[model samples]
Target: MSDPPKGPRVILEDDQPQIAPRLDFGWDQAVVPVVPPNPPSRWSGFGRAAAGVVVLGLGLGALEAANFTAAQFTRGAVQGWLTLGVVVAGFGLIASAGWAELRGLLSIRAVDRARAAFARGDLEAARSEALRWAGGMAEAAPLQPALRQVGSIAELRALLEAGPLAGLETQANALGRAAAVQAFAVTAISPSPGLDALVFAWRGVRLVRQVAALHGLRPGLAGTVALLRRTVFDAAAVAATDIAVDAAARALLSNKLLEQFAGEAAAGALAARRMLRLARVAAEACRITPPR
Candidate 1:
């Protein structure tokens, strides 16, 4: 009977029960397929063919015209030779401009590749990319000695940031600050919202171009458009809450001056914030080794 009554008595452990370890199913590690899910459309193929045909036709027509002009000149027509010379000179200029723009685009791509290499901690790749990028810019001449002495990716990056990149950053900051202040003033004083929009748009584009130039990127029309698109998208990705909080703080401070100016002040603050964000994004986009 005593043994039966004591049978229910049990000892409890002092330590807490252990939780089962989480099992990783590796869903996040799924690799993307090389082939797209959707097949190429026949319409796309047709469109490409049509474009090729149009380009070929244009080339043939230009060649035919050039030949005709040369033949006329051989037949003693001074006007034909003059026209051919003008045409040749015009083509030469166009070709030079196009080549410059292509070089600029290639420069941009090189910077992007260097940035990617740095992000991935590929030291050799990053070093080579950095050297190639710096070689193209005259402003990097002063850093050439230090660059040659770099033994590691970190050293190279530090040298760049302290030398040419530092100067570029300074210029970019000044540009951004000026743009922001101008945006604020314009938005606060302008009566027309349309005018405010236009001013902001112009300032944004100009600021981006200036920042890019500071980083040794002389983007032409196409490059400018590309940089503008990238900067805008990057700026849009910035935390909205952070911008709102900053704007609110500024608004609160400005409210102390005059309640009458509250609405205009808030609008101006928002515009200024946007301009600043764009400037920063543009700088980052143009940097050889963008911030991690």
Candidate 2:
């Protein structure tokens, strides 16, 4: 029966609206937290104490020998005083070196603090830190007037970036390019793996030091080592993700012409890539503020 009116047929599809699947590569995830080092064990503490005692004992023995030797000199009293003066001077030099290293480390820490302050929008703290950082750069002198006019953290960063930082970046780029070329050439032509390793190490150290110096850092041996450690860790973390990309590019570029020198070309390219990465890392580490 045509019951009342044939109710309009209702159609229902089985599929619901599908949301585009979002791919999370973990890029937006919080950085992996660093595990704090274990506290020093009792044995470690005892070892350190024993080493200090041994050092003191050796120093005392050396002093006694030096005193006896001076006593036998023709001008015993004058010689003793001279020896004392020499010893004092040596200590003075050592103290000066230590102080320099400490200053360098503090300078690096100041850059870190300034970066953090600016990031948190603490304009007052940022201004103080910016001024302190600028004070160390002779190139920043002419930019002082403009810097004084900066009323915001962003403005301060902009001024520095367009001014002294720009020049420093240019110099750093040149240094990095030179180092990369040297690495490529050495790796391609080096006869022994040992020599290649030595050259790479030497160039890396020199490049890092030059970049650090360009950024107004006077990192001494200890400071340089610390900076190197940080740079290597950072660069390694970044490069790990890039290795597949680099390999793909290398494969695409391998042609008949390159095939003739394939081994050398691959080694050279890899070396250059690593050196460039190191240079970039070192430059970033020594920068007063994060790049825009």
Candidate 3:
């Protein structure tokens, strides 16, 4: 009688932010697992040494058994020793390189574990892990206020989830400060220019992906690239920041450039702050929540 029941009854509810499914924050563990290319085996070094010893022994035995002149025998023995020395030196170099590579892998693994802890909402655990690597540098004086306000990983998640625009701005501010300290910590722990670039790139990429995920994006290469493009090209503020950060990080990490400590700190802070802007823009574009 009432126009076929006017379709189904519709109920309206107040608008609110819904808690989206939590994303796994173990990005480093997933992407930067502790897997260094295996160095030449110790056995190879041992074999080289053994071969060198055997060659020396054969030379000595030949010199003792032969009826050659003393000069010829001495010359042959010298050549054998020279060969042995070369082999031994090469082996030493390989061993040194292997040790250095292993140390680098262990350091990266430790960083990954700390990042994983942070992802899983264990701020204290994450902080402790970073402290172990950074030896108090992770908690620089400049970042104390931001860290206090952030309180915990859960609080950060809430800000990402349902907090207002102001909340997102606050989150950005806090995260920017935290990231600055973390970058300094990273550089303190690893002084290599190439290694710093790689580590910071990983950190930056993972952060972008995490924000996208918070806004319901699947973590994948395509999404990450797209969001990065958008952040770099669509948002003027973010784009400007990106340009500035890129220049700073380049200066900070350039082996050819003699960089001062103050310059490095400034570069790191600016890079981090810009990264937060990238995250915010990506999240907003992804529509993590309804527009105000």
Best candidate (score: lDDT): 2
Report the lDDT tens digits of candidate 3 across residue range 162-231: 4333444455455545655676577666767688778767766776666544423354554566556656
TM-score per prediction, in order, is 0.70, 0.73, 0.33
Model 1 — TM-score against the truth? 0.70
Displacement of the residue 154 alpha carbon in candidate 1, Å: 2.0
**Residue-by-residue lDDT tens digits, candidate 1, 1-292:** 3454544666665574676557788775665334566875566888899988977876885788698888878888787878788878876887789888887787678778989788766778887877776776777876666677778778878888888787877778889889999999999889899999999988888998889888778887778888877776667666475567656766676655665566567678878888878877888889988685
The CA-based lDDT of model 2 is what? 0.80
Which candidate leads in TM-score? 2
TM-score of model number 2:
0.73
Give residue 124's error in model 1 in angstroms: 3.3
What lDDT tens digits, residue by residue, belong to model 2 across residues 252-274? 76686765466567668777887
What C-alpha lDDT do the candidate models reach, one value each?
0.79, 0.80, 0.56
Position 138, candidate 3: lDDT:
26
Candidate 2 regions off by >4 Å? 1-75, 238-260
